[model samples]
Target: MKNLIILLLFLFVGQQNIYAQKTIKIWVVRHAEKDVSNPKDKDPDLSPLGKERAEALAKYLKGEKIDSIFSTNYKRTRLTGYPTADKTGLTIQTYDPATHSELAKNLIKNAEGKRMLIIGHSNTVQEILVAFGAQKPVKELTEDDYDYIFELTIKGDKREVKVDRYGAEHHTKE
Candidate 1:
Protein backbone atom coordinates (compact mmCIF):
# COMPACT_ATOMS: atom_id res chain seq x y z
CA MET A 1 0.00 0.00 0.00
CA LYS A 2 2.84 2.44 0.72
CA ASN A 3 4.51 1.68 -2.62
CA LEU A 4 1.20 2.09 -4.47
CA ILE A 5 0.51 5.45 -2.80
CA ILE A 6 4.02 6.68 -3.66
CA LEU A 7 3.54 5.65 -7.31
CA LEU A 8 0.24 7.45 -7.48
CA LEU A 9 1.77 10.61 -6.07
CA PHE A 10 4.52 10.49 -8.69
CA LEU A 11 1.98 10.04 -11.49
CA PHE A 12 -0.12 12.94 -10.30
CA VAL A 13 2.89 15.25 -10.11
CA GLY A 14 3.96 14.22 -13.62
CA GLN A 15 0.52 15.06 -14.95
CA GLN A 16 0.53 18.38 -13.15
CA ASN A 17 3.85 19.28 -14.75
CA ILE A 18 2.20 19.18 -18.16
CA TYR A 19 -0.31 21.77 -16.99
CA ALA A 20 2.10 24.30 -15.53
CA GLN A 21 1.18 27.90 -16.24
CA LYS A 22 3.72 28.48 -18.93
CA THR A 23 3.64 31.61 -21.04
CA ILE A 24 1.68 31.23 -24.28
CA LYS A 25 0.48 33.18 -27.26
CA ILE A 26 -3.08 33.16 -28.59
CA TRP A 27 -4.14 34.72 -31.88
CA VAL A 28 -7.78 35.66 -32.22
CA VAL A 29 -9.51 36.73 -35.39
CA ARG A 30 -12.95 36.97 -36.86
CA HIS A 31 -13.68 34.32 -39.46
CA ALA A 32 -12.60 35.15 -42.96
CA GLU A 33 -15.17 36.85 -45.14
CA LYS A 34 -18.14 34.64 -45.92
CA ASP A 35 -20.21 34.13 -49.07
CA VAL A 36 -22.99 36.62 -49.20
CA SER A 37 -24.69 35.42 -52.37
CA ASN A 38 -27.10 33.34 -50.33
CA PRO A 39 -28.20 36.11 -48.01
CA LYS A 40 -30.80 33.87 -46.41
CA ASP A 41 -28.34 31.13 -45.56
CA LYS A 42 -27.40 31.40 -41.92
CA ASP A 43 -24.15 29.51 -42.36
CA PRO A 44 -22.63 30.57 -45.63
CA ASP A 45 -19.27 29.18 -46.74
CA LEU A 46 -16.13 31.28 -47.01
CA SER A 47 -15.99 33.66 -49.93
CA PRO A 48 -13.12 33.59 -52.40
CA LEU A 49 -11.59 36.60 -50.72
CA GLY A 50 -12.06 34.89 -47.41
CA LYS A 51 -10.22 31.78 -48.58
CA GLU A 52 -7.39 33.90 -49.82
CA ARG A 53 -7.32 35.74 -46.54
CA ALA A 54 -7.18 32.52 -44.58
CA GLU A 55 -4.24 31.37 -46.64
CA ALA A 56 -2.55 34.67 -46.06
CA LEU A 57 -3.03 34.34 -42.33
CA ALA A 58 -1.50 30.87 -42.35
CA LYS A 59 1.47 32.13 -44.31
CA TYR A 60 1.88 35.11 -42.02
CA LEU A 61 2.14 32.83 -39.01
CA LYS A 62 4.10 30.08 -40.72
CA GLY A 63 7.15 30.68 -38.59
CA GLU A 64 5.25 30.33 -35.34
CA LYS A 65 4.50 26.98 -33.74
CA ILE A 66 0.75 26.58 -33.55
CA ASP A 67 -0.31 23.90 -31.08
CA SER A 68 -4.06 24.22 -31.46
CA ILE A 69 -6.89 25.65 -33.52
CA PHE A 70 -10.42 26.49 -32.45
CA SER A 71 -13.59 27.52 -34.21
CA THR A 72 -17.31 27.62 -33.76
CA ASN A 73 -19.44 24.90 -35.36
CA TYR A 74 -20.08 26.78 -38.57
CA LYS A 75 -18.94 26.37 -42.13
CA ARG A 76 -17.44 29.82 -42.37
CA THR A 77 -15.54 29.68 -39.09
CA ARG A 78 -14.23 26.17 -39.72
CA LEU A 79 -13.13 27.07 -43.21
CA THR A 80 -11.49 30.20 -41.94
CA GLY A 81 -9.43 28.18 -39.44
CA TYR A 82 -8.75 25.32 -41.90
CA PRO A 83 -5.66 26.79 -43.49
CA THR A 84 -3.89 27.25 -40.18
CA ALA A 85 -5.05 23.82 -39.00
CA ASP A 86 -3.72 22.26 -42.17
CA LYS A 87 -0.38 24.00 -41.86
CA THR A 88 -0.05 22.96 -38.24
CA GLY A 89 -1.51 19.49 -38.87
CA LEU A 90 -3.79 20.08 -35.93
CA THR A 91 -7.50 19.36 -35.89
CA ILE A 92 -9.82 22.27 -35.33
CA GLN A 93 -11.65 22.01 -32.01
CA THR A 94 -15.21 23.27 -32.05
CA TYR A 95 -16.49 25.27 -29.10
CA ASP A 96 -19.82 26.86 -28.34
CA PRO A 97 -19.72 30.44 -29.48
CA ALA A 98 -21.58 31.66 -26.42
CA THR A 99 -19.32 29.88 -23.91
CA HIS A 100 -16.55 32.43 -23.81
CA SER A 101 -15.37 31.70 -20.28
CA GLU A 102 -15.32 27.95 -20.81
CA LEU A 103 -13.40 28.40 -24.02
CA ALA A 104 -10.80 30.53 -22.24
CA LYS A 105 -10.39 27.91 -19.57
CA ASN A 106 -10.10 25.18 -22.18
CA LEU A 107 -7.33 27.05 -23.95
CA ILE A 108 -5.33 27.54 -20.78
CA LYS A 109 -5.86 23.96 -19.68
CA ASN A 110 -4.93 22.30 -22.95
CA ALA A 111 -2.37 24.69 -24.36
CA GLU A 112 -0.17 25.87 -21.55
CA GLY A 113 3.00 27.30 -23.15
CA LYS A 114 1.57 26.59 -26.63
CA ARG A 115 0.23 28.85 -29.33
CA MET A 116 -3.26 28.77 -30.87
CA LEU A 117 -5.45 30.36 -33.47
CA ILE A 118 -9.06 31.00 -32.55
CA ILE A 119 -11.45 31.72 -35.43
CA GLY A 120 -14.55 33.56 -34.38
CA HIS A 121 -17.30 35.85 -35.69
CA SER A 122 -17.19 39.62 -35.46
CA ASN A 123 -19.38 39.78 -32.40
CA THR A 124 -18.04 36.66 -30.74
CA VAL A 125 -14.49 37.92 -31.09
CA GLN A 126 -15.39 40.71 -28.73
CA GLU A 127 -16.62 38.22 -26.19
CA ILE A 128 -13.49 36.11 -26.52
CA LEU A 129 -11.21 39.10 -26.12
CA VAL A 130 -13.12 40.12 -23.06
CA ALA A 131 -12.79 36.65 -21.57
CA PHE A 132 -9.01 36.93 -21.84
CA GLY A 133 -9.15 40.29 -20.11
CA ALA A 134 -7.44 41.81 -23.10
CA GLN A 135 -6.22 45.33 -22.80
CA LYS A 136 -7.09 47.94 -25.45
CA PRO A 137 -9.00 45.35 -27.46
CA VAL A 138 -11.72 46.32 -29.88
CA LYS A 139 -15.25 46.13 -28.57
CA GLU A 140 -16.86 45.27 -31.89
CA LEU A 141 -16.11 44.39 -35.48
CA THR A 142 -18.12 45.46 -38.47
CA GLU A 143 -19.28 43.25 -41.38
CA ASP A 144 -16.73 44.77 -43.72
CA ASP A 145 -13.92 44.06 -41.28
CA TYR A 146 -11.94 40.84 -41.62
CA ASP A 147 -8.28 41.74 -41.34
CA TYR A 148 -7.84 42.44 -37.66
CA ILE A 149 -6.04 40.03 -35.33
CA PHE A 150 -6.00 40.14 -31.55
CA GLU A 151 -2.73 38.60 -30.48
CA LEU A 152 -2.46 37.85 -26.78
CA THR A 153 0.54 36.75 -24.78
CA ILE A 154 -0.44 35.19 -21.49
CA LYS A 155 2.04 34.66 -18.66
CA GLY A 156 0.54 33.34 -15.50
CA ASP A 157 -1.85 36.08 -14.43
CA LYS A 158 -0.74 38.66 -16.98
CA ARG A 159 -2.26 38.98 -20.44
CA GLU A 160 -0.91 41.41 -22.99
CA VAL A 161 -2.84 42.15 -26.16
CA LYS A 162 -1.59 43.51 -29.45
CA VAL A 163 -3.73 44.46 -32.44
CA ASP A 164 -2.54 43.57 -35.91
CA ARG A 165 -3.90 43.31 -39.43
CA TYR A 166 -3.62 40.41 -41.86
CA GLY A 167 -4.37 40.29 -45.62
CA ALA A 168 -5.95 43.20 -47.45
CA GLU A 169 -7.11 46.01 -45.27
CA HIS A 170 -10.84 46.58 -45.04
CA HIS A 171 -11.86 50.00 -46.25
CA THR A 172 -14.96 51.05 -44.39
CA LYS A 173 -16.68 53.93 -46.16
CA GLU A 174 -17.08 56.90 -43.91
Candidate 2:
Protein backbone atom coordinates (compact mmCIF):
# COMPACT_ATOMS: atom_id res chain seq x y z
CA MET A 1 0.00 0.00 0.00
CA LYS A 2 2.86 2.43 0.80
CA ASN A 3 4.56 1.77 -2.55
CA LEU A 4 1.29 2.20 -4.43
CA ILE A 5 0.64 5.54 -2.73
CA ILE A 6 4.16 6.75 -3.58
CA LEU A 7 3.67 5.84 -7.26
CA LEU A 8 0.37 7.70 -7.38
CA LEU A 9 1.93 10.78 -5.85
CA PHE A 10 4.74 10.71 -8.39
CA LEU A 11 2.26 10.43 -11.26
CA PHE A 12 0.25 13.38 -9.98
CA VAL A 13 3.36 15.51 -9.59
CA GLY A 14 4.54 14.59 -13.09
CA GLN A 15 1.22 15.54 -14.59
CA GLN A 16 1.34 18.92 -12.85
CA ASN A 17 4.81 19.50 -14.23
CA ILE A 18 3.62 18.70 -17.72
CA TYR A 19 0.79 21.16 -17.39
CA ALA A 20 3.15 23.79 -16.02
CA GLN A 21 5.46 23.31 -18.95
CA LYS A 22 2.81 24.56 -21.34
CA THR A 23 3.75 28.21 -21.74
CA ILE A 24 3.17 30.72 -24.51
CA LYS A 25 5.59 33.56 -25.22
CA ILE A 26 4.82 36.51 -27.44
CA TRP A 27 7.29 39.08 -28.80
CA VAL A 28 5.83 42.42 -29.75
CA VAL A 29 7.48 45.47 -31.24
CA ARG A 30 6.60 48.69 -32.97
CA HIS A 31 7.16 48.84 -36.69
CA ALA A 32 10.50 50.15 -37.85
CA GLU A 33 10.98 53.69 -39.09
CA LYS A 34 8.91 54.77 -42.05
CA ASP A 35 9.80 56.88 -45.08
CA VAL A 36 7.91 60.12 -44.78
CA SER A 37 9.10 61.50 -48.09
CA ASN A 38 5.78 60.91 -49.85
CA PRO A 39 3.28 62.78 -47.75
CA LYS A 40 0.40 61.86 -50.03
CA ASP A 41 0.98 58.14 -49.67
CA LYS A 42 -1.10 56.91 -46.76
CA ASP A 43 0.92 53.73 -46.39
CA PRO A 44 4.60 54.39 -46.64
CA ASP A 45 7.22 51.66 -46.59
CA LEU A 46 10.22 51.34 -44.28
CA SER A 47 13.14 53.68 -44.73
CA PRO A 48 16.74 52.52 -45.21
CA LEU A 49 17.48 52.76 -41.52
CA GLY A 50 14.29 50.85 -40.85
CA LYS A 51 15.43 48.11 -43.18
CA GLU A 52 18.68 47.75 -41.26
CA ARG A 53 16.77 47.73 -37.98
CA ALA A 54 14.48 45.05 -39.32
CA GLU A 55 17.51 42.97 -40.23
CA ALA A 56 18.89 43.50 -36.77
CA LEU A 57 15.57 42.32 -35.30
CA ALA A 58 15.72 39.19 -37.42
CA LYS A 59 19.27 38.44 -36.32
CA TYR A 60 18.40 39.00 -32.69
CA LEU A 61 15.47 36.60 -32.78
CA LYS A 62 16.99 34.09 -35.18
CA GLY A 63 17.42 31.34 -32.62
CA GLU A 64 14.07 31.83 -30.91
CA LYS A 65 11.37 29.25 -31.58
CA ILE A 66 8.91 31.58 -33.26
CA ASP A 67 6.01 29.54 -34.57
CA SER A 68 3.93 32.39 -35.91
CA ILE A 69 4.17 36.05 -37.02
CA PHE A 70 1.42 38.64 -37.07
CA SER A 71 1.47 42.08 -38.65
CA THR A 72 -0.99 44.69 -39.70
CA ASN A 73 -1.95 45.18 -43.34
CA TYR A 74 0.05 48.38 -43.57
CA LYS A 75 3.34 48.34 -45.43
CA ARG A 76 5.53 49.49 -42.58
CA THR A 77 4.37 46.81 -40.13
CA ARG A 78 4.62 44.06 -42.71
CA LEU A 79 8.07 45.19 -43.73
CA THR A 80 9.23 45.25 -40.15
CA GLY A 81 8.12 41.65 -39.61
CA TYR A 82 9.24 40.41 -43.01
CA PRO A 83 12.84 39.65 -42.19
CA THR A 84 11.98 37.50 -39.21
CA ALA A 85 9.26 35.71 -41.13
CA ASP A 86 11.65 35.03 -43.94
CA LYS A 87 14.32 33.79 -41.60
CA THR A 88 11.91 31.42 -39.82
CA GLY A 89 10.25 30.32 -43.06
CA LEU A 90 6.86 31.23 -41.59
CA THR A 91 4.40 33.26 -43.60
CA ILE A 92 3.38 36.54 -42.05
CA GLN A 93 -0.27 36.65 -41.01
CA THR A 94 -2.14 39.92 -41.26
CA TYR A 95 -4.33 40.98 -38.36
CA ASP A 96 -6.89 43.73 -38.35
CA PRO A 97 -5.67 46.73 -36.42
CA ALA A 98 -9.21 47.86 -35.78
CA THR A 99 -10.03 44.77 -33.73
CA HIS A 100 -6.99 44.47 -31.56
CA SER A 101 -8.79 42.94 -28.58
CA GLU A 102 -10.36 40.20 -30.65
CA LEU A 103 -7.06 39.47 -32.34
CA ALA A 104 -5.32 39.26 -29.00
CA LYS A 105 -7.92 36.86 -27.64
CA ASN A 106 -7.81 34.67 -30.72
CA LEU A 107 -4.01 34.54 -30.66
CA ILE A 108 -3.90 33.65 -26.97
CA LYS A 109 -6.50 30.96 -27.47
CA ASN A 110 -5.39 29.43 -30.74
CA ALA A 111 -1.63 29.77 -30.35
CA GLU A 112 -1.33 28.71 -26.76
CA GLY A 113 1.95 26.97 -25.95
CA LYS A 114 3.62 28.61 -28.93
CA ARG A 115 6.05 31.45 -29.47
CA MET A 116 4.78 34.24 -31.71
CA LEU A 117 5.83 37.68 -32.94
CA ILE A 118 3.59 40.68 -33.48
CA ILE A 119 4.64 43.79 -35.33
CA GLY A 120 2.46 46.80 -34.65
CA HIS A 121 2.51 50.57 -34.72
CA SER A 122 3.56 52.96 -31.97
CA ASN A 123 0.01 53.44 -30.71
CA THR A 124 -1.08 49.82 -30.97
CA VAL A 125 1.81 48.10 -29.21
CA GLN A 126 0.72 49.31 -25.78
CA GLU A 127 -2.87 48.41 -26.49
CA ILE A 128 -1.93 44.85 -27.39
CA LEU A 129 0.20 44.57 -24.29
CA VAL A 130 -2.76 45.69 -22.22
CA ALA A 131 -4.93 43.12 -23.95
CA PHE A 132 -2.53 40.45 -22.79
CA GLY A 133 -3.16 41.50 -19.16
CA ALA A 134 0.31 42.95 -18.75
CA GLN A 135 0.84 44.35 -15.30
CA LYS A 136 3.23 47.10 -16.20
CA PRO A 137 1.84 50.28 -17.68
CA VAL A 138 3.51 50.77 -21.04
CA LYS A 139 3.21 54.23 -22.45
CA GLU A 140 2.66 54.77 -26.12
CA LEU A 141 5.88 54.65 -28.12
CA THR A 142 7.14 57.83 -29.71
CA GLU A 143 7.12 58.24 -33.48
CA ASP A 144 10.87 57.91 -33.71
CA ASP A 145 11.22 55.10 -31.19
CA TYR A 146 11.84 51.76 -32.87
CA ASP A 147 13.92 49.78 -30.43
CA TYR A 148 11.38 48.59 -27.88
CA ILE A 149 10.57 44.90 -27.66
CA PHE A 150 7.80 43.73 -25.34
CA GLU A 151 7.97 40.11 -24.28
CA LEU A 152 4.82 38.55 -22.86
CA THR A 153 4.99 35.11 -21.31
CA ILE A 154 1.83 33.26 -20.36
CA LYS A 155 2.14 30.20 -18.18
CA GLY A 156 -1.25 28.79 -17.48
CA ASP A 157 -3.14 31.48 -15.56
CA LYS A 158 -0.05 33.55 -14.83
CA ARG A 159 1.36 36.25 -17.09
CA GLU A 160 4.72 37.98 -17.09
CA VAL A 161 5.75 40.94 -19.20
CA LYS A 162 9.12 42.52 -19.85
CA VAL A 163 10.18 45.43 -21.98
CA ASP A 164 13.51 45.15 -23.75
CA ARG A 165 15.26 47.09 -26.50
CA TYR A 166 16.88 45.75 -29.65
CA GLY A 167 18.87 47.02 -32.66
CA ALA A 168 20.92 50.21 -32.86
CA GLU A 169 20.15 53.28 -30.80
CA HIS A 170 17.96 55.72 -32.68
CA HIS A 171 18.78 59.34 -31.93
CA THR A 172 16.00 61.78 -32.57
CA LYS A 173 16.76 65.36 -33.44
CA GLU A 174 15.68 67.93 -30.88
Model 1 agreement with the true structure over 17-131: per-residue lDDT tens digits: 8886798898999999899998899999988999999998998789899888889999999998888888889999999988977989877767777888898888888788778
Clashes of each: 0, 0
Q: What is the Cα-based lDDT of residue 101 in candidate 1?
A: 78
lDDT per residue, candidate 2, 80-174, as tens digits? 99999889999999998878889888877877789999999888888887888776446557877798888999876688988878888886424
lDDT of 1 at 7: 100
lDDT of 2: 0.87
Off by over 4 Å in 1: 1-21, 172-174
Residue ranges of candidate 2 with Cα displaced over 4 Å: 18-21, 172-174
Residue 65's lDDT in candidate 1: 90
Compare the candidates by TM-score and give the number of the best one: 2
Task: Write down the TM-score for model 2.
Answer: 0.91
Error of 2 at 116 (Å): 0.4
